[model samples]
Target chain A: MPKDSALPSRNGAASPGKEPRTARGRETLRRLLDAAAAEFGERGFHEASISGITRRAGTALGSFYTYFDSKDSIFSALVTHMSQSVAAAAAAAVAPGSTGVRREREALAGFLAFARQHKELYRIIDEAEFADPDAYRAHYMGTAKRIAARFDESVAAGTMSPGDNEVRAWAAMGMNVFLGLRFGVWGEEREPDDVAAEAERLLRDGLGPRG
Target chain B: MPKDSALPSRNGAASPGKEPRTARGRETLRRLLDAAAAEFGERGFHEASISGITRRAGTALGSFYTYFDSKDSIFSALVTHMSQSVAAAAAAAVAPGSTGVRREREALAGFLAFARQHKELYRIIDEAEFADPDAYRAHYMGTAKRIAARFDESVAAGTMSPGDNEVRAWAAMGMNVFLGLRFGVWGEEREPDDVAAEAERLLRDGLGPRG
Candidate 1:
């Protein structure tokens, strides 16, 4: 999986007019976001402090203000950053020419691995529901839209059966999210590939009885 | 669906030694929980206050202390109560002879209806992750266990194909959760049965290309 870009300028993660311009500045922004993830993940939004985030980043308090005006700004940015990171990870995992179930399998596998490494991902995103509802909604809505597009592509390619791609996308996204929660964050007994494979089978054949 | 019992004695929702004995006492306890749900659901854990809960319940402040030790205690009990309510809703929705995908469909449909009526259910339960971690874990773990058991029963009865029931259970639960979030809580544009039928089709046939 590709590393989450430290400079997600294209995604507008940084506050307007405060976007990092130089390599050094981008690195500083990245560190702050990473630190924000840790602070918020550990202490949650209400308890997390700007000082705590800057301390975790090992950057000066002024640097925190350089990129973000306040804790809420950084948190909203962090949610967007994480959402982009998840998308990048899944996209990078899909081999060129892969389609249909195979494409989704690789995506799920990639997400499982990402979730394992970033256990705080779930906590932070889940917290956004209360702290930053818009960002939370954007994350899921954007993800489901991407998944729906994949379904549309696969159907057009004659690789998968067609139905309500929108509903299917939501269902598939839900499946991946919970699988990651159970296998990736909660426990690591199951391999990502293994979990994805079983889930892929379910997606491909479902639970209908076989002859 | 059956009303969430005001006195969930079997589930041990009330703080120890505070379980309401008389019918009137049970009704008050029930009111307190419903009120707690609204308070926590609307204001969230951090912002929610004990006074707010009692005001919503229309009960005296002393009555709140009689059943619950503090706001935390009532929040914990509310999580369990909500979890039980969700279970009761799903169980009551299932027909006696239903099995396999049909049974799961009914369960999802039931939950969607319950969620729509109680939009705050998601907010309260999700907040439990931060406010009451044990209850959070208990809710998902318990729900997944029940779902896995249903899969096991269906497989044993030859109504469905056998696979990893535990993983399948989590996947199905995730699917139901997101669907409920989208259709139940966020919008009422889609009918519960209509959404369930689409999801049921996916569960029954999957995304495989049909001849």
Candidate 2:
């Protein structure tokens, strides 16, 4: 996927003044998003303030308004940005020609590593369920769709059995999510590669003993 | 397992006035929980009120105080109660002699059915992650433990391949949860049995094509 394509589509017509025009404007937008992640991740949506985000970013209050109209719009964008980051992480981890279950294992390992580093990812995305339900639904739906697409490729390559790839994709996404929750955010006692390998075993051969 | 043993243990010494001793008191408690479900489910934790719950229960203020001391306590108790309810639903669905993946499939089917009937379950439980962090973690941890125990049973009965059952159990629980979220809460175009069967196929076998 192209870098920008991974992120959620914004409505330029809805917010006319929000789009960044110059390279400096894009940098300012990035800074604001990082700062918003800290503010919202620490104080949550209700308590977090635009001033706090601006202060954390070391940007003027006007800079915040330059990119985001309100706290809600910024939050919605942050979620989309984070969702795209997760996809990008997984994409980076999978090498070219990585096939079937191996591809899934790599994606899960990448997610695990990302979650460990960005612990705030959980709180922010989870809060989106209540703060911005559309983003929350879109994040998971988009993720599952991506995984389903992989299943299609693997099936064409004769690397995986052609079953209900849609269901299988959702199941795989769920497995990665909870595994990340347990081993990634909660504790890093287990290695990401080890966790991913176990998951791959389950994905490839399931619970039954192999001959 | 004994009926009461399936539920989480409460510390009586922690809160003395909260427990009801009489049958009428128990009935009142049940009414309060059901009312709470509606109140919290519709309005969320912050906006939900004691009087709203009481009005929904058709009980007096005095009656509300008979079991729960405050809104937080009731929400905590409600989470535990709902967790128990989920376990009970699964227990009831599994047959006496069901083993291995069959047992898990039945449990998933039962959970799906319960989720469909009690749509508020997702909102209330997911809200607990923020509202009551301890209860939220406990719910998933306790659930994962039960699933791991089932894995132990299956292994001893020669019904399943023995690997890292702990990780396998969590993976399985994650699959069931997301499947429930998608098919159960988001849309019910698919049947519960069909979902469970597909899940069973994934669990018993895997993504690899059958020989």
Which candidate has the top score in TM-score?
Answer: 1
Per-residue lDDT tens digits for candidate 2, residues B1-211, read 3333333333221125676555466667778889999999899888999999999999999887777778998898888888888989998999999998899999999999999999899899999988999999999999999999999999888888888888898899999999999999999998899999989989988887567
Interface RMSD of 1: 0.6
Docking class of 2: medium
Residue A19 lDDT (model 2) = 78
lDDT of 1 by residue, A1-211 (tens): 1244443543366787887766688789889999999999999999999999999999999998888989999999999889989999999999999999889999999999899999999999999999899999999999999999999999999988989888899899999999999999999998788899989999998898886
lDDT of 1 at A68: 91
Q: Pick the candidate with the highest lDDT.
A: 1
Please provide, for model 1 over B1-211, each residue's C-alpha lDDT reduced to its tens digit, 9 standing for 90 to 100.
Answer: 1254543543266788987766687789888888888998889888899999999999999998888898899898999989999999999999999999999999999999999999999999999999899999999999999999999999999999999999999999999999999999998988788899989988988898887
lDDT of 2 at B136: 95
Interface RMSD of each: 0.6, 1.1
Model 2 score (lDDT): 0.86
Model 2 CA lDDT for position B50: 94
Worst 10 residues of 1 chain B by lDDT: B1-10
